[model samples]
Target: MTHRTLFLTGAAIALVATAGLGFGLGRLTDKTPAAAEGHAEEADHEENFIALSVADAAKAGVLTTTVGRGGGSELVLPGRVALAVNALAALGAPVSGAVERVHVAVGDHVSAGAAIASLRGAEGANARASVDVAAAGARAAAAAAARDRRLFEAGVVARQDWEASQAAADKAQAELRAARAQVTAQGTPSAGGLATLRAPIAGIITRVDVRVGAFLTQGGLVAEIADQSAVEYVFDAPPASVGAIKVGDEVLVQRPDGGEDSARIVAVAPSAVDAGAAVVRAKPTAPAPRIGSIVSARVILAKGAGGLTVPADAVQTLEGRAVVFVVEPKGFRATPVITGRAAEGAVEILKGLNGGETIAGKGAFRLKAELGKGEAGHED
Candidate 1:
């Protein structure tokens, strides 16, 4: 073939190959939408169920609970364990003095009149010396008054002189009594010019603010003792829920360690606190928790007839709403629920569940996570 003839033939062959390639591309582009639609349909058919084999479910610790009836409405209040007011005592320095010695430490158990510490200072010495002087003066005045009374009866002394002696004796007696009272109020005074600090109530020392050689001013706190045999749970209840809490209502105290104690509402403040929360006090029916422990409280507001109830752990937060996983033959399905009060490990379900529905109790979160994963896969 000549050069011109060869070029024309090559061009024709190239044109045919380009046209075939364009046709193939057109067919692929036309089928792309149908294939994508099929994929979309498959994703749409993906159910919101988490299927697990028996072995897998067992490994996940999936447990089922049947919806039941009977549980009262409860109002949960946040509070801390506090020493009973009548069972607590605050010790303070009776006189300004330097602490000579500290006998007890924080957490020490002490009895009434037990020596806690000793304080030494001029104030204590002066108080004791005044007592001694007052006693001597009183004794001298009493003797003179008795002698003057006898003389007056016999007309051996003037009436004015006898009367004056009697008045002097009475004044001296008053001074003596006042001095003794002062010493008694100051507590026991030691021989070394130290005032001994003593526990006024039998209790466990909860606080000790003084140390050896520490100078304490008068009325300064030395220690705090609490009779924790009886403690009260003081909690702040929302003002909206205060009306439901009445004195004598049953309360459940949940400790930080997951233990529970029963209590009864003893008192409720008439007004709200700074956060518009009411202060409620409850006394434990059994042994109280350690003082100063922060514990959760559930106050039973009212009990109604049998209502739908489920395990509290079964409830989970999904999409910012309370939900529970219902066990189906294929898998578990997440169901939105309206919850009411909760008590004694069970929560009152007002809606979204009928009685006898089997639900995931302990491992519901596993199902929720699986569902989330499936949704994410479909999105991708």
Candidate 2:
């Protein structure tokens, strides 16, 4: 064979060897199932992510996100239901007397001018008799005065005599008026035979301090009538809390019978009661509060003005500044923010953040610790 033919034959031989090697390599690469299984095991190791257990999270007081509305803060106050002072009536005797009869009993509803009790007094009878005598004298004097005036007009009587008669009649009339005023002032029935103790205002009889034949002093209370037409809640709170409460602020009244009523703060005592507790007065809705009933008061302190706010737990204290942890794609970041009035569980966000930002609702302390640990590790 010539030299060129020998080289061509060598090249063909090398090509056949290369084909054999390629075929062996292809067979070795054909075990795809085993390689895939190995790769899956390796991924499983990397998938072992860490997370907190349910019990642990609960123990840490971890909470989830919830949408909060306006009106953020309220201060709870303890109070008791009371009768409006104006609605209370103390059935007292205008003169010293013995209770002849109790016209009404406890829990009875009475109207204005309705009799609740009757009193018999010595002064009362004397007052009636004096008024009657004065009225009779007044009629006689009036007739005499009219005759004297006619005589003076006709020039048949001396001017001094007519004037004297007029003066006498005037004096008698004044005496009669005085006697009638005395009777009225004694609470005697006006033109009626019985001196009945009538209700000054319409309401329920909450107390009966007198029975038949009970002796009472002048102006002494005999029964207590409560006009439950309007009820009030009386509260004694600390002076520190007084600044947050004001008239016309909304109040929540909680009853022991599992009932709730709404009211407005109508009054606040100018000074403290017992020099320790401040007096607060509120007027509840209709269906008046039972006298002396106990209730709870929730006075609003701060209200939201339709701004961004978050739960207090979401805020973290860092380096003496109010900080909140915001979870980002990379990790959590401590963000300083300005806050406004806080109510209940929410606080107003005045600055440093806008609404719709996802913040760490809970478990932010753990992230903070992790960051601290990372910093220590780097220092080491």
Best by lDDT: 1
lDDT per residue, candidate 2, 232-298, as tens digits? 7898776655665778988777788887788889888855454977889988764645677878877
**10 residues in a row with least lDDT, candidate 2:** 45-54
TM-score of each: 0.56, 0.58
Native-vs-model 2 lDDT?
0.73
lDDT by residue for model 1 over 234-323, one digit each (tens)?
Answer: 998766556657999999999889999999999998554456678899988888767788899877765666568888889998887789
Off by over 4 Å in 2: 1-73, 158-164, 189-194, 255-260, 270-274, 301-380
Best by TM-score: 2
TM-score of 2: 0.58
Candidate 1 steric clashes: 0
Backbone steric clashes in candidate 2, count: 2
List the global CA lDDT of all models: 0.83, 0.73
